[model samples]
Target: MSPAASKRQADLLKQEGNAFFQKERISAAIDAYTGAITLCPNVAVYWTNRALCYKKRNEWTKVEEDCRTAIQLENHSVKAHYMLGLALVNRQKLSEGIKALEKSLELGRGAHPASYMVEAIWQQLSKAKYIEWESLSRERATQLRKLKVACKEAICNYNSLGNPAADAPEEQLNELEEVFKKAAKTDTPTEVPDHLCCKITLDIFRDPVITPSGITYERAALFGHLHMVGKFDPVTREALEPHQLVPNLAIKEAVDSFLSEHGWAYKIR
Candidate 1:
């Protein structure tokens, strides 16, 4: 086959894979994308598409392998990095995963600040950062507790040695105690404001939409409720439909501005 014909064939396979993926036929989608990759081995998107299929099945190793190939083929591929980050996270490689996620966020923001993917990448990065922060905070607290116990022991030994004039160990113990108290206070989790959250998902607004009744919800969550539950506002129980929802630009901008300063808001439960 000529290169042009092979490229055309790969494009057709990609479309088939997309259709299969949309239908939730993940195995078939993977096979289709594999065919595309076989036809056009240098194409980065084919590898990423197959990686997404693996991701759906929780096959972290396959996802990582395919994403790495995609990244090698196209270093600046945002989806490649994003999926790689998720794959690494599933594999329990948090630090590496966070780096990949941060790269994806940076690329996505540069390419399309208003794209759905930019927000998705930002949210994932924020959650990863929060998890890392929480883990480190716990470890530090544990170390501080151990240090406090040891400091008190040292002070006791110093006093028992008939060295009551030795203020050095006692002063160190007081300083350590004060540091532990401050750490405890600083580690307390802050609550996210309810107004910033979607009623159905109770998550920070991603694509917020307001209904006629002045109730706002995450776009996808509201769509799910309307399709699966009923065409009424989840909060007010008022009559509503998918068409009644309007993009709340004011709220969206507010949420975006807040997240710019407080990425930790993505730590929503």
Candidate 2:
């Protein structure tokens, strides 16, 4: 076929890939985009699209490779640099990633708000000394479910299953559920960034001393966590503060009573 015909074919493949991506048929989309690149190796769009698929797949190395290729082919590709920075940020290479993302912003390119916010949040994390995960609760679980859908659909990768873009296949979802079950079963303290840590901070940063008495032990402990190293918002402060569900006693006392009633650990904090 002529070069023009080949180019046309490549474009068609990219379209097909986009369609497959919408359907959550990630593997199919990758194949299509890969074919497009093979047919027209110099097309930057194909590489950028394929890089997105890699990101969804959680294959950072491949995402970086594809983005680099796209950038090399077309230095003006804002999408390529933005996504490259995104992948780098998530990989904990925040400094270089910030630079790339800043360039994308300076170029006034991108339709993704999450990308912008992530970069902004990372700027905060880079300044902090410690990060802690929020005590995951029902609300967070709901948010994770939403986030999982968005990331998967948006990124188009196998590992993007837990993302907020697309719903993973049932089997993968089940596997993920099991993993979360194991994690929730443990009391392990996990490190979280300022953004997420800020989310649950309300629960940790509240006015535990709701009564004339001193702050409840649990609320005090939770407050200590909030101010231990980093700062949190007042809303988060109030949320983390333990209160009295009992007529006069602390919420921790009630929790202890329930734990004793169930023969679990008496200490709620």
Candidate 3:
């Protein structure tokens, strides 16, 4: 067959693989993608598609191999790099995964800015970072998790009281606020811990915000970055808008507690 004919045949197989994949016929999708790759070894998409099938099967080694082959065939293959990053992270090669994800983000920004896959890539990167952070600070991470739970419980109890009438006793609301504020303020540390600081501002968060990507940052700092820099998240490079940020009340409470305990941490240079 001529090269054009061969490519067309490969395209048909790829489309078949896509259909199978969408149907969740993972093994059949793999077979179709493999057929495409055999027919058009030079096509990066064939390898990437096969890699995705392997990913669905939790076959990290095969995913890594196929994505590497795809990247070799087409250096600018965004899906390949993104998949490779996920495979690497699954294999506990976090640093390499982060680099691959960053490369994918860089390449994808110009070519496929609106692709939904970009969000997945960013989420994977975020997971990798969280894993790394947890590994390094397991104890502190546990503490933070507990603190978040406590904060949530506090909020839930307050809300369960129901909406008070506008004129009904302002003192009651103020008293409740003071109680929690006092709890957070009871123990001031001499120095602010690194984990408590916002990654973007390198300072304590006054108002913490969480993005859909599961990253937390200072509200104003993240808002500014989204508006002034780009719509992509700072940590994961995922697409995000200011409106997508949710107030991370738990983290906010935790930060407030930390600050209260370590009043000196509030002294910013």
Candidate 4:
């Protein structure tokens, strides 16, 4: 096929995909996007659109892959990054997801602040000194609900069913709300003590800026949290450890690898 004909076909597929998406026909939309990608794989938008469709369809893995491809084709694509971030966030890949969303913001999409929703929940509630978690925005509350449930699931999967916090019973979720009020912010505040319950206090899961200091970005973030509300648990503490936790290491490495692979300069220190 001629280049012009391929471009025209790709455009048509994209248009049909958009129309189907607007009608809430996720599968059809995906099919159209797939067609577009097949016709002109060079255009990042085709992959990006398909990513969104997969996201709406709850095809989280596909969403991540498509968005990653889109970003590779157009590194400045805020929408693509945002969509990828949401997919990761929903899958509880909080560290990596937040990193993508933050990149989207840096690329000029502030309204896409939805990336920070999860951390914000536990952080903010901790700051208020009350457990009025039900008052969160609908979407945010839903994410938290999911997070709570996921924590519960994790605990159950690990055979630690007795820990009510991990299980997140209503009373426990509510009771934990008060920690936010007394939290502090620090770039390197201490990690959560092994015996203490883990949680974010104060709605400040805001990303911490990493400079030339010996601290990792996540450590800086933990410190920022400490400065804001002075509270944390095992979950937050893993960031600064010499051998960062699995999820944190994965994300930190992903960013560095992504940048390095693309010939962009970034340093951990």
Candidate 5:
């Protein structure tokens, strides 16, 4: 076959693969994508499509391999990079995944379809980074508590003695305060999880309430929004009434438990 004929055949195969994928016939989709790749070995789309099929099967290794192959064939393949990033993340290689996702975003430049993928990558990266920072913060807090206890013991021992260490405890406390201020400045601010935040106010929910549309929102915020803007779901734009709102006890309990565990996250603001 001529090169053009070969490429056309590959394109037809890819379309067949897409149809199968849409129908959730993942095995058939993979077979069609494999046929396309065999016909046009250099085509990045075929490799990426096969990678997507592997992803549906939760086969991270195969997804990563196929995505890498696609990337090698076409350096600027956004789908290839995005898929590789997801595969790496699934394999617990977070930093590598983040880098690949960032590269995909840079290459795509907020293009349609890929823009949504880029946004998802950003959210996952942000969540992972936040969890890492939270762990570090807890460790630092524990160390600081230990140091404070040691300082208190030292102060008590000095007071028991005849030695005049009048200003020493105060000075030590001032120094510790300075250290804490510096640490706070250096540390990343705690982030409220998206699920815990109210859609209307964008703050951590004190009392989550579910609307008839099955979307959760903070009670007061949603009530105020309903009163002001007329009864409607902010997210789904579903027609709703104030009476349709119901308390979401499950989400409220989750928020309470999270706050209790991560007290530092419960800022006054």
Candidate 6:
């Protein structure tokens, strides 16, 4: 068959796959997509379609494999990255999954800023980040506890030996104690950056939205303020409406990156 004939056949097969997928015939959809992939091996969409079918069947490993191939064929394929992220998460590779999801969101936002798919990807990324933060927080707490115990033990041993010449120095022991003291000082609130915080709530932004006046606010707080007060910007006090609010993805991403590095900040509420 000519190259053009092969391309036409592949397109038809992909259409068949889409029809099967719409009817919830996942196995049939996978088969159709596989046929398209076989004919047009370079087509990223065929591989992504197959990956979607695998995802529906909870076949995460296959989804991962297909998505990886699609990404290799077209690195900017948002669907490929999104499916790969979910597959990796289901396969117990949360960190890699989160990265893939982040890339998908970045690409989706750039290519389709107002696309509904961008919001869906953002929601998944949010959930993934939360899970990662939760796990890391518990792990770090356990490690801190162990370190404090070790520090106490070292101090006690030095004291019992009456400061033997070979014992750890008093300076080292003091520093270790100081480290735990600071670590245990959970009462000291994490200092969130001014730009990442809402002016109205004075708290770190969870869901940031931008007003028409070019000011950002926490979504819930802004909504509450508008309901209780009036249709005006809290900071500017200019005429504002709910429809004028837009998601502040840049600030939200910055907050997410900061929280990822400083899991302690997640407790700031």
Candidate with the greatest lDDT versus the true structure: 1
The TM-score-based order of candidates, best leading, equals: 6, 1, 5, 3, 4, 2
User: Model 6: number of clashes?
Assistant: 0
Give lDDT tens digits, candidate 3, residues 41-85.
998989998998999899999999999999999999989999999
TM-score of each: 0.69, 0.43, 0.52, 0.44, 0.58, 0.69
**TM-score of model 1 relative to the true fold?**
0.69
lDDT of 6 by residue, 61-163 (tens): 9999999999999999999999999998888799999999989988986786545677678778877877776676677778898988887786777678885
* Reference-based lDDT, residue 58, model 1: 97
Q: RMSD in angstroms, candidate 1?
A: 6.3
Ranking by lDDT: 1, 6, 5, 3, 2, 4
In order, candidate lDDTs are 0.84, 0.58, 0.77, 0.57, 0.77, 0.84
Clashes of each: 0, 27, 5, 27, 0, 0
What C-alpha RMSD separates each model from the true structure? 6.3, 22.6, 16.2, 17.4, 10.2, 6.0
Superposed Cα deviation of residue 136, candidate 5 (Å) = 4.4
Give residue 267's error in model 1 in angstroms.
8.0
Report the candidate with higher lDDT, 4 versus 5. 5
Flag clash pairs in model 6. none
Q: How well is each residue in 28-91 modelled by candidate 1, as lDDT tens digits?
A: 9999999999999999999999999999999999999999999999999999999999999878
lDDT measured at residue 51 in model 2 versus the true structure, 0 to 100: 89
